[model samples]
Target chain A: MSDTSANRRQRVQSAETGMSVLKALARLGGDASLTAIAAEVDENAAKVHRYLLSLVQEGMVAQNAATQHYHLGPESVRIGLAALRQCDPVRMGEMALVRLRESLQVTCFIAVMGNRGPTVLRIEEPSLPVTVNMRAGSVLPWLWSASGQAFLAFSDDADIRVQAQAEFDAGNEAQRSMLAGPDPVARLCRQVKEQGCAIVIDTLLRGISAVAAPIFDARGRVVAVLTALGASNGFDARPGGKVCPQVMREAATISHAMGFGPG
Target chain B: MSDTSANRRQRVQSAETGMSVLKALARLGGDASLTAIAAEVDENAAKVHRYLLSLVQEGMVAQNAATQHYHLGPESVRIGLAALRQCDPVRMGEMALVRLRESLQVTCFIAVMGNRGPTVLRIEEPSLPVTVNMRAGSVLPWLWSASGQAFLAFSDDADIRVQAQAEFDAGNEAQRSMLAGPDPVARLCRQVKEQGCAIVIDTLLRGISAVAAPIFDARGRVVAVLTALGASNGFDARPGGKVCPQVMREAATISHAMGFGPG
Candidate 1:
């Protein structure tokens, strides 16, 4: 049987451009003049003004009457909060990392399997911060980084495998070895699932080793991966070391908070 | 000099309606058909479809290809995360509440004064689980609840007072005394400001008591209130009790996290 719905997956280009105007405003510190926003989006000021009018009307953007500048509105914040409440492993995992940061004076981060790849959602650093360039919105390769590998190892969803496979196929020869040859990705994922954690040292970032643990949801699905990044000199990420157990325990705490059972 | 900008306080009615369609979807559990969204927002299906197209373009909403159902898109989540990162006292307060919940074995909640009232943003519950009716998005009254009182007590912002005055004026004769007569709201606010906490017992719900402390922003403005709710029999809300010290300590920690210094 054929589907009859007329909904199109192909997004309208003008609408995308209009939305880009809002992103430009957000990127420009959430407030900017029409000319600035237009310049940022590389569109005409008149066209950007019309889009801003629609955005202001929709309560997604706000305009200051005196300055004639635009920023995010109250309704936008409310909508964002609603979205965060829905499936936010970011907020749920941040607290656990804070505790882990207290135990070990290292930087901790959380990554989630997003639409494109495993994206960093939050980062926690101790008082003496490490030299890390990553922040929220940084997408990591699924088979390369420890956070990405933790996601790959714990996730059993078909949709996820499709995306990871795409990332694997479009990779360099070294990257191809991760999902093929002697040490396949499937076997690694099985090991990660069995051990409840994953580790990588000096793989992605230079002199930076990261160990990540998978956070499961109520259905035991890997929703997020919590990772700790520290210098290779002092950090230990072996299977039976102090790092893995603490990370695993914190992951379990977050998983329980997310409604997973006592397992 | 007279201001030349023609921006009006009145929102664009159509844009409000368009935004309402998204709220309708969120209220309907974040996914619904066009017909359902139209019915909820009191608009026609065809007009709603046009708005949905714009939303889809903006990446604020997504339409499932097979079922033709609409839900939050990735961009909406990203925008929300960015907003949260900008001024998220909710996330900053939740971690302290988690630590408090660990020590007390009681449930804690964070509420921010929203456009309507102090709305619950996050809830931290222990494993045993207390009998609680409130959840995230539940709005608490400014005059009747502990969370509202905590907000009213510590906030010196003139805009906040206007809203609180409106809430006070809307109440019955008994509530007017809380603002006008012998035991004025100003006096109570002063007391709360001195003590740094507010308590409400058997006010809204029977056999349940709640204590709240205000969390301040960088400028020493009350941004959110951290509240602990427990059964009346086991909980204490007095100034010298165990609960008050822990709640206030946690509140102070959260305030520091939100950029408030020890003043």
Candidate 2:
């Protein structure tokens, strides 16, 4: 390679290392001493400090005057919020639902926790559409529908609590009996957590089966739910079934796209 | 310098250039082609593309497969969320309030738009307390208080509209005349926006005057309002007065800390 090419390649390598340092700072939970960041990125403290000075100058990282600990700066937050605004759940979910419908040959949909409840945002039906009552704007039942169950299973929000209680109080005897126990909600939630998804068969609607999984944001909050439903006669809503895992995988993909993952 | 030292310095320079490329992308609204980013940072497209590849590898930027336009990636969102989580408005407001109280020798406070109204979250008093009826948890009226008006002026939210209208309807005849016009709310909002801060003199309380300004988040949403108040005799609540500018400066400082600014 020419000397100029070599210099350019060296510069790119250095830039990548600097980005790794920034990523390490974020991975360290957004606040850490220079020493800690250097250790995290496996670089010497002096070298890390130099990179940090550049980051600070660019307003991507800030050093606290009191503690000298580096944290993400306004530029980082601005960039993130921009990314957040761009990564629309409906758009991403629509793309994922189409892929799921094509691959699994089932009717798939995405639902977001709207002010009212789990409101369906997007739906993709296979060549043979599943004749369920739900449409794009259908608000699924809190304790009955698979999508709502998945959200309830993962959330601890006070608003969700009120909505769930109201739904339970308004349910008829048969609906209440389906979740029969001293603490049926807790039991159902525990089961869903254990299975990594929520499954329901002929519960929310007659002859309808569904499997759903929660999509989490970077903050580990459930932002949306992905669900696949079909006729109970043909759909397998079992915990360890093929559909359950597929739904979970798609949900995980969306969550990953939203910057949620294991630390 | 030794060859090794020269190489290290060159690497650092390259890293800074790469970061500039990333920042330029963010400045361009978080999505752009390599050519656009290169132009934004005033670098050659080839050099910008190389830096983008490094950023893409680090997951701080991603190129859309269909369009090949680069945007902030998941890691950028993750880091920004960390920054957002870290930049607590209450804590930052508390610090700013203390400074305002110390510098101006006036009672200063910060309020967030809570469910009820503009709810005071933090308050700092000068050596002599203002002796107001309000406390930390006091909920200021939407149309009456400077803090509330600052928020109402900046926000186009339906919730704020409902709350402001309710406050207007519940006001007594004398209180209603305080904002007298065909569309008093619109007039007040327009004045506040024009002033870039809200000011009130003996409007909410008999002997009190206050100046408040909105603290915005990364998305330019008013997340909090910073207010300073004193006895009507001592306080200067005019738009171009010393107190109004101080309050606006402090609020802008906090907003910058929260990642809000002009592009």
Candidate 3:
């Protein structure tokens, strides 16, 4: 190969090794002795120590003055917050919708807690799309919609409570009966939290069934909700049904992209 | 020299270059084209492209499939969040106290919004200590203490408002008179917010004055308050004074270390 082609094919092995050491620090819970990091990365202590020195110089790893244990430094925190600032939930959730549509063959959408209520932010439809009335920017009811239920269950924001109270007061007799309790809003929320996802069978719309799951941020706050629905006659909305796991899994994947889980 | 000694002395230049590229991408607001990143790092496009490929493989960088722009990837987010999890405000504030004690020759302490109120978590005393009765775990009053006022000015937590109201209702005649007006709590909060830092001249303790500033987290919430105090007779606690700027500067530095600034 020519020099240019050969250079193009060459990978920077030292950089890759450095990144491995950094990842090992993260996997060790962001704090460890030099020996522990060396053992975790399966490298010799002296070599790992050299890389740690370089990392400390770069401000990616810091050493404790008292104990000499190494931990991630301020630059890592700055870069992570920068990455988080770029983590667009709507864009990531849209990718999830496309995947869910293909896997479950059902219409899927992502909703965020907007000023009014849970508003649909993005949507994806199967080849044969379900004829739902909702579209992007459609405000889902706080009590009657699966997306809203997920928010009520997972989020503790005061605005959700206000909206829920308003819906409870204005709910029709049949709707109130469906909620079925002295404190129906609380009861519904408790049920959804216990179930770990929200399910609706012909509740929000006639002949439609849906499943919804919450998406969380690094701080463990619900940032959005992912929902999937189809005709009730063919769609299974139970927690154990096929659509439920797919929706929850997709929601979790988006949450991971949003930096939600363990480091 | 022995081969082993020679190897030990060698620094990984490629790894350092890779880290520089990553930092450059972050400086470019976490998203940019290959040409932009190369120019920012002052490196040749070919060399930067090779580093980008390695970074992409290591999951530290991602390219937009449509636009072909590079951005920080999931691994960077994960590592950043990991670093954030390791960010302990009390531990960092303690170090800040040590520095302030040396340079400013004042007693410094860090307080967090605990269940009761602004509770002192860590304290550092200078060589010539101020004769303060409070120690770590001393919860200061909401309306009287500079630390408490920092939270009042910046935080929107509902609990703080309730605590302020309770303090307002229970204030003694003299204390209530000091906080004069139809809505003294609101007025105090507004004044503190406008000032950008809370100042107390012999308000909390006779002959003791303090300047307190808020320390923010990545989410821009006030995580802790740092205060420096000395005898009011000799101490200059006004905004334009030497003590006020030093306290605010230290708090801002700690906030930056806590990932509270621009990417």
Candidate 4:
């Protein structure tokens, strides 16, 4: 029994080492040498080299003869894009947000309810001085701002909300109470249903006003939220700023295209 | 010697099998069970299971407990996006094309000289009834389309042009002779140098016209081309429809942003 337990521990450690190598390569932006990878993972070069060789043999890693550097092979991108496409909510919302950023000349984003809170899956910014620089994979908590509210309003999973509330409560009791008041999710849901949009003022970033709407799938399930953000000053200057209605309409258009019914 | 050669052959076969499994998972949109992956790759489930265990241990694959299926892990996207950022020329050109499509409500594309010919890297279309549906990754031979001509005109690589000519010559003598006249690349370079743009009408896609300009890097090398494509009827109807100066201006704007010299 002692021997079996020791073997299992060794196996687990080996698995962790393999995972560390993949993560180190990933964090290096898919391009790294064995030495660099070893340094990153704080492992011996010989050990990392063996792992890399195995990955290369598996076609997940390819070494360029000219550069003598390892890169994530074409198969990596192929799989990554495929996985992204499977998340129909994020994919469709990103496409629509791309169009919206073009039309409105503002920063657009798609956020989803993640384990932590709202995770920004996509961001499109116009060539403007005041443009936001947020990109994909950025996570923010629920009490931070509008994106959080938009996500909370549309998410149908009660357990997820409970989890999010517990996290929020642990972090900031005042903000959690404010967020929990009058059943915020229920009220926001009714507003989203009635107005087909959510207007958030100074909720997330200071002086950054935004308009957002829930993105639904073919099953009328809210999968994501689309938001356009910019400086609060002059936000309502141009017909309530081109982004608000435009974002709402674009979200609706995307939702419709995804086979969702009208609000 | 025979035993050594057989061992090497087996290794290659295993690598190929691994690649096939990866491709199958990508085609399945990044989620697959061992059985599904085995069926897709025409392999035994046991063989595929071992490969999957390796992948999972590496954190390249994550299993959904509810579905008991595997999908691409977040690490994949991190690497892919990093690879994308390093290829900044493609991203810069794509952003310009996205802007042009939004502003003009026309079809815009970015094409680069690939091994075969001109490959479409990105395509942005206006939300219109007659929008073009040209997919990304579609390759077309050089000397057959406006994008090809644009790329040829700006390319400094002599071998690429020679190879492109050889490909053109392999088809028909008459077509080769037509393409051979006046060194299209030289003329295009001169025209782009003087006017900062290139316009081609019915040269590639029938009933479609295009105006393109070279985008230069900070080092002043032409890294990519920005193009605006539209219906020939509409193009011609709008004042020298085949020669829209505004399209050229937009391309120049993108080039300037990309650190090109004055148009």
Q: Best to worst by DockQ, what's the order? A: 2, 3, 4, 1
Can you write out model 4's per-residue Cα lDDT over A1-263, one digit (the tens) per residue? Answer: 12355334333344445546656776786788888999999988876776666556554566655567876654454555554455466654656777877776767788877766678887888788255546788876544556766666666778656755565657655455545556665655566556666676666566777777777764567777887877888565232456667877788765654445421
Error of 3 at B137 (Å): 2.2
Better structure of 1 and 2 per TM-score: 2
C-alpha DockQ of every model: 0.08, 0.36, 0.35, 0.09
lDDT per residue as tens, model 4, B1-263: 12365344433344345445656876676788878989988888877766665555554565655577877654444544444334355644555566677767778777766666777787887778244546688786556566666666677778767866676657565445444446654554566556556666666566777777666553456666667778877774232443456666665654544434421
lDDT winner among the candidates? 3
Number of the candidate with higher TM-score, 1 or 3: 3
Residue B110, model 2: lDDT of: 90
lDDT (CA) per prediction: 0.74, 0.84, 0.85, 0.63
**TM-score winner:** 3
Ordered by lDDT, highest first, the candidates read: 3, 2, 1, 4
If both were scored by DockQ, which would come out higher, candidate 1 or candidate 4? 4
Worst 10 residues of 1 chain B by lDDT: B1-10
Query: Once superposed on the true structure, which residue ranges of model 4 sit more than 4 Å away at CA?
Result: A1-20, A88-263, B1-23, B50-54, B87-263
Alpha carbon deviation, residue B19, candidate 3 (Å): 3.2
Compose the digit string of candidate 3's lDDT tens values, residues B103-199: 8899899999898889999999988898999899999987888999998889998889888989889888877888878888889999988887899
